[model samples]
Target chain A: MRDEAVLRHSNIWRPETIEDIQTKAELGRYRIRGFSALRSRVLPSFDDLTFIPCTLTRVPLEGYREKCSTKTVLGTRFAKKPLELDIPIMVTGMSYGALSYNAKVALARAATQAGTSTTTGDGGMLMAERENSRVLIYEVLPSRYGMNVHHLRMANAIELTVGQGAKPGTGGLLLESKVSDEIAAMRDLPAGVDQRSPCRHPDWLGPDDMILKIEELREATDWQVPIFVKMGASRVYDDVTLAAKAGADVVVVDGMEGGTGASPDLLMDHTGIPTLAAVCEARAALEDMGLYGEVQLIIAGGIRSGPDAAKALALGADAVYVGTAALIALNCNKPIYVEDYHKLGTEPYACHHCHTGRCPVGITTQDPELVKRLDIDEGAERVVNFFHAMTLEIQMLARACGKADVHDLEPEDLRALTLEASMITGLPLVGTNVVFAGGPGWKKSTHR
Target chain B: MVRQVECTGKTTREINQEIRRLIGDGEQEIVVLRPQARHNLGVAVLQPVKLVFEGSVGYYCAGMADGPSVEIRGSAGWGVAEGMMSGTVIIEQNAGNSAAASIRGGTVVVRGSASARAGIAMKGGTLIIQGNCGYMTGFMMQKGTIIVCGDAGEALGDSMYEGRIFVGGSIAEFGNDAVIQELTPEDREFLTSTLTQYGITSARPFQKVVAGRRLWRFDKKEFATWREAL
Candidate 1:
């Protein structure tokens, strides 16, 4: 007979939780990690919603023959030159310090090839990235590392970053292992030091001050490029309104599932709302303020596939920014370097050791030896293929729903597969004509 | 050539545009009148010209300019001459918080007392305060010199990376990772020359504060320092 004590385990004191407690006790500090959160409890996601393709009730376009336009335009409100893209997909800001030189150049090349844009992250713009990119969006993060006015004039667009979704309330963290001499020089910090960026901008404090800040950027750029205000998705409704009111040409909302190079594990899992809910609230806030189409919206965080991008577009995003998914396409966790992954005390496909700065794939490390493993041209080709595939998927879904243009695929074409998703999206449940819960200020329009 | 631009009827954008236009037209010295504490005056003037604000200006006056010498005759608001690449900004009277914040190059001189967070996150350049400054002066300073001719408030040079702060008068408190260092001959010479150039004189010897370098890397043994630094 088996012992009853061995069979009965307390739910609160699971093995993982026990390990975490023991590890913290020994370390005397919170665990720092990389990548997105690893929450066991599932949150409402894009997978919980499915499109209802047109049938006899509605005339469907030929999926194979009909053209579905995916063209997207952003920052048209006050910018003399707005960002126009052939597709709705853009690469999000991943800093040069967080990513290797090869990875940054490859992303830039791929973005240029795909007729979209790539953004510079916390660290200042790399010269090679500028040379490779056709349209580059320079991010002015809180740290202001390597901030130069000459470089600011070279950008096609500017993103004023308040906070990222991974660790909303805190600044960025680069462990000592990643603070190489070159990285240190770029960031103006000492070599081999642990760098923690400040959470607040040095000059501006609140939205009232931000209006002048935006004007300053405009004056610096000669009002040539669009100004985008990016924020972590918490209190999405109020924050979106504030950003729009602050004279932002574009508002980018990064949800809780957003990826990071390094952050405290507790903050990654516990902070910010999910992308599914953030998009809804962001749309409601814009529509409430009567600035829905006038002020372009870009949704980010945990967007992996074409279906996810398509859903974001239908939910009112002018475009979508992909980070971790793009990294995955460049072989972030592929089983090529099993030995290195093992050395980091993890295996491929389950490795979250980016904070250690010994990235097996060379995508997120500063080590010269590891960085040699990634071939820039080859990585760029793979990312371009992935972008093409994702675009095809979005077009296929839009054509199946009788949409000539992908932006025409509205909320009416979607039905929630779960009760929570139904409530979150304000859409009807599958095989039901009634919506159980209308999302915050979500107006229901009659089907045509 | 000297040009006069009035700020009474025009918007901030128009005033800045007029400044740019006059600069482009080879006007070397431009005088701004009405001087009703407007924000963002003479912003991004890349040319090496002179801007004289007849009176007080609001936030971010002469911010992000590459090459320009700006003189404010009256008091100024927050972030005066922030992110300036090259040039000189002289404030005649009491200045608001965060004056000369995150400037990369050039010198910012506040003739009168300044408020909190003066010279915060200074990448390079010199910040001179003729009178007493408020709390957290020279916080997170990376590389530069900050000379305060009078007493400084609490937490001077907090978490500084690689900069030198010289306070002529008493310091309320020192910030984390900040330690008092003996002033070198070079420090004394720089202080004397810079004060004379800015037309300020000091009575007492100055104290130099620098980063302790304890918070540079993480160590399990230095848990006490890490606790506060983190």
Candidate 2:
């Protein structure tokens, strides 16, 4: 036999791939997991672009001293009352079933304290969540589980969800381990059974029908709150345009990197467009229809820090929604419970066992024992600190770019670090004046 | 008191606002004229009142309403009383697709034939169709009662969780996990009372359809059943 160090691994048929095949062979089904994708290949992300602060051309405000407005207003088109947030960052929708009761309340409390908005997810509004939140966005998902008219009336905004990023064109999945008695009762499902939600809304189908559906929702709320049409970032240009045309006050595009509580590993690894590319397409779509500013755009998926949020805003987004990051702030994968994490067959930072309902730090599990580990007030404080830090980082970048308001940070303030980023965003690469490929404006020019 | 509103030049917004204002101002009965099949009329009317639509109405007429009794003299478009919590909707003529979709509780009576997917995803309510019904009737129905007086098209009661479907005409084909059950005296009594309340009569003996519960939980041994259900 040759020396062990001299042995070369096959690039095509890798060790991990072999293990995956064997696992599936034994299970006789696709593997299920939680969290975002674990793709090994590098995708174009916000990190590919860097902000160009004022050097000699533009005047820079003092980063620490100057006041930069983080105020974000969404849904100026047709809503009587739009969402007014203190910061451009918001807590994305995560269902009560996907997260524990303690986790939901903590997020709501933190959002209220931070003066931002929090959204309800697939399982409908938790009464405690509503009570804890100052500004609540009600989601009208395909499942329609626990949907109530009284709850609809009580919401500040309504989000008509078409799809999500992690698993587009499919319904939500909650594995048997996470489907507790309370969750089952709320969702009208049997306890301890894997819950697969419906992909299509029972009432409507296509965009034309969606127009009527929007009208119905508007009528339901007495046209008092904004109606947001949220979809996974596939066919972003067409989908965004249709959503805007169908009378959406706000359009949310969730990219492929978005997180989920439980999903097929295959779907998590492969589906939808990247958030960076998605924002460009969405902005272009809105601009093509001459409704860019009229209909607000919110971006979600893989937005980790202030730099990412700033880059997204510079690209075109009015606001950014964070899901996994918020959960992280609530101690989702903390290393405190070393033994518990080991028992789940994962390490502290490498844990993606949320689908198993055995979360060590207790943000995503329904088990009472795990849930008790997360103190609601302490978790809320931690998340509030994270939100503050993110908001400060965003403000610092905006001030450095000579923007008085975070929303004023435009694409001109950004420069691509790579050729792929330059091509995707239509931005000039650093130290280069050439635009390598067609960008957001390419579609408009072709149509003309 | 009775109030009449005209839909000649006013927008759907203006019309709905006026209807709500009238309801707020202690009007027990409101009649809408020349609806022109406009969509989203009398939606979200939580007050207990009576609404009379003189002509045909477009999509989602009386949608998301909690408490109201609406009478459409002409035909109705899709989702006639969708998401209604508790109410009564009576359509005089034919209804378009997905009529009474996803209603939690209420009574929807379609006097004439109804199009496809009627009573789809109904949570809890009673849907009475006097004439024929199109395909996929009661599809994914959770908890409700659908009474069809005439022929039922293909794929009836598909993937339903828990519901009762009584068809008075020839069976087309059952959908996945949907099974026919021998009707009991209690089911017959409920159907008779519901149909009679809606002024509907049928000559043919009704066949009851319900969920087989096979799709409720996944079983590895029942691969064929799971394959179709999934």
Candidate 3:
């Protein structure tokens, strides 16, 4: 008696699920794709949090006249010179090999203009990036690709990347097509060969060994630069605590929605927690050890706008890092490259073919022809504009919350729209007195 | 007169600054005295100068040397001559693990024995070790030549790609995806010229090692054929 049209398909074996299973059976392999955690899941995020703006009890700062400072400092605990920024936003680590040289240059130039730091990702420091970036964070990953002591000294900070959010338990992949001569040279791999970076550092097996490694690196750098430990958002509480105990000046947490150049589609969708949950865990871990503000926390992954950045800060993150958003601001998937997009078997706004090394907009490719499509000046200007816009939005939010400084905004300034968000962030539910048990109200829990 | 910098009580930063200052002033000949195992000597120096270290050095000695010539009279610690773009680093004594790692283009001559993972990930560089090399020499090497005058330890060349290794002495082991290939005329010439340049006279036959050509490419259709076979 049921209508056939109403009962389209069962949830267990949906059409796409069936197609994926059939494809796996035929190819005898899992799907490989770019971008991270794109599966349709209603994960609680900043969107589920609404700011409690100042009212009669507190006076709100005027948007134009009031002086609200966005200046932020990181690595104060153990670094001789901590990173000072005009804004709390930073450019996350994106390797030169994964991104075109032009794109790297643009990012460096833009970050410099914004008075914020840009990070040197997996494949070491590019000459152009070093020359253009006023402040640069050098990442030392498991692969040790293009790593050298000289470059280590050249950095403002050293980010020891234990894992990435996209593929926490897995390594990275630079397929053969993307392995151009320059990329190959930088990574010390053969031209036209797939490069697989290791999942864990060769020198360190656990936190005990990591402590020694951190000391070694610190001594090598003359204790001038800060040491940051970046971990994927799995076991954030334990990992952050260990990193802090190991003398890390800063801890960076990347969530599931972080982008990658190339990763198995299965891993992207299945691994790691969301950015919303990650910040809360990291903060709780730091606070438990009485090292929350002493060791700055920077969170990334799916940070799209000013609101997202503000939300992260409210959840106890000192700063926020952006990657995909910065790339998009530089015109990653604009309508002009529709023809190139079609050639890559994708289109604007839905493109995830960064692994192909044939990026339509020239952001992720090493191909010279496609690389030239992005003008460095225009791209840098656009990135600067994006940072400005995002910072403006953050200041507005902070002002409306009646905070003179961006860092003054606390968890009390926010309320979760959903119970899930309230539980994750430990913030109070909107229009409710209930302080959820796994959240900030539970004094016995480490989250308090 | 050669510009001299002493590292007796000075920190690495002071020594580095003095070296940079001397190099910036176009001092071609520099002498470092009382190194006392100080690390990062002559690091990232791009000038075409000659630097002579009086004593043993620590980790990353002469790293990222672009065009300078660095001579270490004594032993060195880990990662010596790492990522040298172009230049010459002569270690007259022994070297620790990961020597000449990821070197792009340069000539690194280790007169004494080398520990594990020597010449790891070397790209377009030449590493000549007069003595034995420990396990995993030339591990994951790419587009370079590594020559050992003495015996090679376990995993002679593991997972290498497009690089050539010449072991003048007996080999103990070979790692995954690494196999011994017949010494070709080109390889013989390269080995001979490299050995002669480093003043290494060896009567033992040299065996060539290269990637097994199994992991050169990955085919989705032939997944098991490649992954499992390797």
Best by DockQ: 1
Model 2, span A357-390: residue lDDT tens: 8889988999999899999999999999999999
Residue B123, candidate 1: C-alpha displacement in angstroms: 1.0
lDDT of 2 at A183: 91
Model 1 DockQ, alpha carbons vs. true complex? 0.45
Give the per-residue lDDT digits (tens) of candidate 3, residues A58-110.
88899777999999999999889999999999999999989999999999999
Q: List clashing residue pairs in candidate 1.
A: none
Worst 10-residue lDDT window for candidate 3 chain A reads A439-448
lDDT of 3 by residue, B1-230 (tens): 79889888898778888888898898999999999987667677777899999989987788767888999999998778877888999999999988987788889999999999899877778999999999988877777899998999999888787788998888999977888899989888877787888788888889888899677767655543222221
Q: What is the DockQ of each candidate?
A: 0.45, 0.38, 0.21
Find the 10 residues in a row with the least total lDDT in model 3 chain B: B221-230
If both were scored by DockQ, which would come out higher, candidate 2 or candidate 3?
Answer: 2
| Candidate 1 per-residue C-alpha lDDT over B38-139 given as tens digits, one digit per residue, 9 for 90 to 100 | 988887778889999999999989887788989999989998988888999999997898888888889999999989989888888999999999998888
By DockQ, rank the candidates, best first: 1, 2, 3
- For residue A115, give model 3's deviation from the true position in Å: 3.5
For all candidates in order, the CA lDDT equals 0.89, 0.89, 0.85
Model 2 segments more than 4 A misplaced:
A5-7, A441-448, B220-230
lDDT of 1 by residue, A1-448 (tens): 9998789777999888888887777667787879998999987899999999999878888888988898989999999999999899999999988999999999999999999999999988899999999999999888888888888999999999999888897899888888889988887788878888888888888999999899889988878999999999898988999999999999999999999999989988999999988888888888888899999999999999999999988888889999999998888999998999887778889988777788999999999999998999999999999999999999999998999998888898898899888888888899886687777524532211
- Any runs in candidate 1 off by more than 4 Å, and if so which? A1-8, A444-448, B220-230
By TM-score, is 1 or 2 better?
A: 1
